[model samples]
Target: MAQTATRHAKLWFAGQAENWALAAYEIDELHEGMEDAGKYHPTHKQIKQAIPELIAQYVDQPLTALEQAINAKNKAEFIANYDKLTAGCNACHQATEFGFNVVQRPSFNPFANQAF
Candidate 1:
């Protein structure tokens, strides 16, 4: 059951990676899905390690920090953080032995002028 839930979480993470602006609720649901899968599993453990930034981004005030980064006009730093998040996705895929299944990185963010 844990592994099944983990698989589902992986799916959510994959979709989230593909389009983060789809819905903010998806993020916490993904995290909760991962947590519900158990902490002992490798992917869950990796998620435990990887969630701080996510928490920061969603719960721990990631958007404000993003605003600060943007305010500073530091596209590089933003990209670095975005890359860090992507690395987490890669880390989990690698740990799950699906390393060949490279997760797609975000391209052309869909948040600029679209109605949510």
Candidate 2:
């Protein structure tokens, strides 16, 4: 159960990173990956039920920072802050003793329609 939770947490961060990268770049293919992560993420329930709402209450974050950064047209800022958010995801995973999975930055831009 602990390891499972860790995987879920890891997936959450990866998906969140993908989400922000896609949004910032306006890439449809990366966005599609993010969408898939959303659908298949392991922690979707805990995120909606506990983790996210709790963070929104206690911390200054919960991945919305990426959305705001992108909206502000600060791609550099988005990338910088995105590292922290992605780190948090890995932290949660490690805390749960599931350090096998490591999330990484997106390498290929898959947006078919628009350029960022």
Top lDDT hit: 2
Top of the candidates by TM-score = 2
lDDT of 1 by residue, 1-116 (tens): 34433433443333434433332343355445545444444333335444443333432243333334434545554445444544555555565454775544434443445333
Clashes of 1: 3
TM-score of each: 0.38, 0.45
Among residues 3 or more apart in sequence or in different chains, the pairs in candidate 2 whose N, CA or C atoms overlap within 3 Å are 28-111
Question: Roughly what TM-score does model 2 have, to 2 decimal places?
Answer: 0.45
Deviation from native of the Cα of residue 21 in model 2, angstroms: 11
| Cα lDDT, all candidates | 0.43, 0.47
